[model samples]
Target: MASTTEYSDRESLGVGSIVGESFSILFKNFIAVILLALAPMLLSSIIAGAMVGADVALGVADPDFSTSTSVTTWVLTIVLQIVFYALTTALLVQLAYDSKLGRPLQLGRYFSPALRAALPIAILTTISSILAGFASLALIIPGIWVYAVFSVVAPAVVIEGAGFGGLGRSAALTKGYRWPIFGALLLVGICAGIVNFLAGVFAGVLADVGSWAMIVGFSIIAALSAGLTGISIALIYARLREIKEGVTVDQIASVFD
Candidate 1:
């Protein structure tokens, strides 16, 4: 299933092209994209509820920062975050390929690959997060650099099934293309930030009218931002793979060849 397409040879589609293509795919399957984006939030809530229920049954009080309950919550949150992000990554990778091939999108195709890809994705994601954290602690530039460098980790994990090796693969693929990835990531961040800022402003206005609406709206905005960010990251991975692995639109077109 590897046909080299013309787009594959055009690695210089650069930042604008990448972002445009991502948004195009997103809009084409807006409903599916939104639902995929919402999946993590919904799953998290369900898991948290179950945890809380178990804690209550065991007579556990609300967790304070010093308590085991707090630790458990943090652990659960991290695990859930990894699983959700991995799943989103796999789904988006499949979607990207489908979009490129002019094939119909299918929601059912998302989960299995996600599950298969989870471990490597989780490891890469965790490492990237840690590196970013250390860089942030050192200086903002380093943190941002680390983030840009590892931007394609999810895509590597999903497409290559690189597992723990995904981070290294992403780094290698992105070696000469740092600025492009950085620009794309920055663009996504700026757009998401704007959406978030607008959401906060709207929430404040709604709060003045009704607190519940404000809370609900804020929650929805947060979930949408997460999903959109995840999808954008996945798109970046696809583009990088096409460039690094020499997998082009033509190759994609001649999958059976």
Candidate 2:
């Protein structure tokens, strides 16, 4: 019934409320958030580092990136990274809902659904990111707009079990609120970006040729950033459903049970 309602009949997206709730959720579950995201991120880095080798990632030596072999390796690394990113995002989406609902954080229960959704999420999200990347190459604003359009793919896929249709679902939900959504994401992203930058600088501590400190430190920062970003997206998705379809968070979280 609510889904049949027009956009004009719906409420505002409430960027501020979503942003506040995202920060609250992330702050309250800070350690758990980081840990939930750490494994996939750390593995991604290791896999990418192994594929590209120290010469490329650390610049310890000059390797011809123009070579076909090197190009294939880089592409493979990107694909793997996207898969891990999707997996991490999927995990965090479940955590966000459970945490928001004040439910016990059963991290294990989350994995079953997350793993089931990860492949489709990875595929659709790769398409979204590639589109965003191309738009970014043309201009920055278009890239942000494109990203905002599909910002909730992970949550939609995992929660609604929408699979490949997640992209369309996100696009539809975000249609009228892309700018506000982008604003909310950018505000939170700036905060996370600042921390990530500091961590990057701190990672330089006694580090050269991609030392363990650099690897582990950046991975930790990335894990934290991923956690915050994923939580924001989850909250945004829930808010969008509430605004446009009169759906409650409880209704959305019910799928996990």
Candidate 3:
């Protein structure tokens, strides 16, 4: 997995290399990535807050799921979170390729394609996530494997226009490389988890501060987490394509142009 064999002639799926480059691309375009992620995150948070009190949605207050309002709040929040996640991943996929190619970020043009693909990506991602969640109930490793198998879904849907078939496309691309992909994702996931943990602590501290402050704080952390995860997944998708298809980053970015 780490080294290329003469017979294979494919690029090496270097886990460390992909993880290292993901961080480079992230920090290099940190502001842009965060900003791109923030919009959808904040909007979702605001909507959730409106349905249930901001305090309840942000965990500052107890959630009374017994109430109908609280149940609706949970449902709407979960659905919006998935939709926003799909949109964010779609936006970042383009940005990651552009960042990798050293092209100026095109903030304005990203939304059209991202918006167009968000629902399908959200639907497919929801199905995969549900499967992963169930697998995790029996054992954690199976869950992670399930996630790795369909990990490149958003990139496939957004970049290749691979609608509902994105699941099959991702499964195809990831074949024979699931473990390496898992390793790369695990390393990145740990880093993201740590950051999110710290963000939680920060949110806990802000609980007494005020509603708006906590909203801002929570949105920022959510955006940061999404930015990291989305960026890494985008890179992984590009790397997989390059290794399997001999496609260059420039060629991948050309889809947005």
Candidate 4:
């Protein structure tokens, strides 16, 4: 049964192959992926709107973030955003891997594992951000490189229960293939961005009749885009491990076991 989803005989995936595989997985499980992604996407959108609204109310295009209180607030907002992202990303990874393993997926049951992973993932995300920030400080290219390489850390944590070591595990798995990973991810990002821009424009131009309607339209589109991207990343992580370590879908899905 393990061989059912094995990629051991296939050559390692390149940029285009990974992107194609990701979209294939996403389309096959579109409803599940979108539903799993909605909560975090909605919350993130609201947070961003609130921040922008607050800035508008303050009458400052760029507020005094240098102030202690403002800095603290900005930091807290960032932390909350990361926490939401971590939770949502973990859920998506579980969903994607389970679907690939041919498990009967239940949305509610998936949250349990994600909840258990919340704290460790939050910490892992924060540390990765810091490290990526320092790397960027050294050189802008290194920062982008660090982010692309460590992109699979969240999925590693979800699949392998690697805790904080997920960062190292991801780095290890992504070794020698960072360029392809980066290219695939960049393609996903571009596609997602285009979707988002179109959604926003559609909402603003056509759905301007009601504020709530616009918000709902934008949120739904954003959720779909984010969900697809998340699923793609999860697939990328799984295939990389399969190619590099002979890991099977059942092994990646064993977190559910």
Flag regions of model 4 displaced more than 4 Å.
Answer: 1-11, 47-67, 134-141, 202-216
- Predict model 4's lDDT versus the native: 0.73
For residues 81-117, what per-residue lDDT tens digits would candidate 2 score against the true structure?
8778878878988899888889999888888999998
Candidates sorted by TM-score, descending order?
2, 3, 4, 1
Instruction: Show the colliding residue pairs in model 1.
Output: 3-250, 3-251, 3-252, 4-250, 4-251, 5-248, 5-249, 5-250, 5-251
In model 2, the Cα lDDT at residue 40 comes to: 92
Pairs in clash, predicted candidate 2: none
Lowest-scoring 10 consecutive residues by lDDT in candidate 3?
Answer: 1-10
lDDT of 1: 0.64
Alpha carbon lDDT of residue 119, candidate 4? 80
Pick out the ten consecutive residues of candidate 4 with the lowest summed lDDT: 52-61
Q: Each prediction's TM-score against the native?
A: 0.74, 0.90, 0.89, 0.80
Residue-level lDDT of model 1, residues 1-257, one tens digit each, is 11224234455737887778777776777677767656655465445545543232112235335888777776666566555655666666666667657877776766676777777777678778778878889787667778877877776676665788877887787776666666687787788778667766666766556544554455456555555667677666656657677677545324222
Off by over 4 Å in 3: 1-11, 60-62, 67-69
Superior candidate under lDDT, 2 versus 4:
2
Instruction: Judge candidate 4 at residue 44 and give its lDDT.
Output: 63
- Rank ordering of all candidates by lDDT, starting from the highest: 3, 2, 4, 1
Global Cα lDDT for candidate 2: 0.82
lDDT of 3 by residue, 41-112 (tens): 888778878877777767768777898876877877777777787689888889888888889999888899
